[model samples]
Target: MTLSVKAVAARLEIGRIDWSAYRAPASGGPGLRDLFLGLLDANDESEAVGCSLEYRLEVQSMVYEVALPAVGVILAAYAEDLPLWVEMEFLNVLHNIITGEPHRSELELGNFDLVDRCIERARDGIWVMYSRLSKWNSDFLLDVLEVVDSDRERFAVFKAGFYPE
Candidate 1:
């Protein structure tokens, strides 16, 4: 489905969360946009300093602490009118998060749906982030463990052929 505010609202179950409270002030605060940018721009935490944020692990602290909660806002922001470069960045980041590791376990139901859409787009030759993602050969196990996350994840992972049913 096309990414838009309305679509984001419905798909993400948006408006139930106070997104503003997590906005990164000039001083920096918990925000998914910033985290997504950091992942897209820099190589890692050490290099991301100053460019986007001061990297640190805040388990309970508010530096995004985690990205799952902010996926809605992140997607909504993407649907908004962003510059071309910014839009591409968001797409790339979303693709990476859905397809790559994000230091987390299984994806939420909503995010999992997004993954389904993305994979479909790629396989259909509309877009690509390793269409052979399901192909069992290169780093397949790690990909399954890192991206699959849980029993609920089996649907997508199974379709991807990460494992036999």
Candidate 2:
């Protein structure tokens, strides 16, 4: 089920929410966190702001504070048709959080399903080429995650149950 950016914003109650309360220690004025929230296209659903490789340095420097609401936005966007970039940076952090990465004990992730959806998106040709799956050949980011296979046939066997017909 695909959703619009406005729909996601409303579901998260971003309009009425105060971001300052959720600010992380590394978040400076209008940090990547705010950028992540601000990029939500409440008026346009066809597209929204694109995160870049530059976001990797900023997001990683911020200690993946983007994991909470920012990652939340990333997850919500996954169910949408809108294209996104550099999402691997955030997804990488989420994977670390799930794997109990040090200095990430405070993170509480409840949606392991998105990880599955990421793989599904790759399988379905419904995701941007710059997202996580692309890095399998380019940067090998998936090596850090449980899924390290770049070959589709092999991955199909390795992660058989993830894609349900």
Candidate 3:
């Protein structure tokens, strides 16, 4: 079974989303764009007052986390080869949410450069951290790489290997 938006919604127990309300037609909300831009620019500042202000703002604006049941299901289903593009999209969405930007906002347009960088970092980290686990337990990392390379389609259904036939 492939993970669909409807399936994700059901899993999250969220009522039907108003698609129209979520629609981003372009050239909307400057505040959100500015916020995202600022978030992207934010660096580790040691100034006590500035840091305190930024922290307060972040506490009020940041999303902290997002519920991604669909992404989780797809990853588990295609553990043999995790789709990089899909995973990147999921990460981008999470990043946007964390920055206090609306997931479906027009201002939250896809940032391919940032997405690529994040994917590369994630791949490197996974290899470094899981290499021993892969060697001892199974070829999980290899399977993930294979799945990511094989799946080219966006938002496709991924059936778990253990799913009933």
Q: Please name the candidate that would achieve the greatest TM-score relative to the true structure.
A: 2
**Predicted candidate 2 versus true structure: per-residue lDDT over 133-163, tens digit per residue:** 5423333333322342345665454334333
lDDT of 3: 0.29
Per residue, candidate 1 scores C-alpha lDDT tens digits across 1-165 of 444333344234333554355422234343434454443344444655543323321122222222344434445544444444444443444435346332222232223343444333333321122332434332432342344334445435545555456
Q: Return whichever of 1 and 3 wins on lDDT.
A: 1
Overlapping backbone residue pairs in candidate 3 total: 5
- Which model, 1 or 2, shows the larger lDDT? 2
TM-score of each: 0.31, 0.39, 0.23
- In candidate 1 the C-alpha lDDT for residue 129 amounts to 25
Candidate 1 accuracy as TM-score: 0.31
Over 59-138, each residue of candidate 3 has an lDDT whose tens digit, in order, gives: 33332112222223222322333234333333344333233432332225553233233233334334332322223223
Candidate 1: C-alpha lDDT: 0.38
- lDDT order of candidates, best first? 2, 1, 3
lDDT (C-alpha, whole model) for all candidates: 0.38, 0.39, 0.29
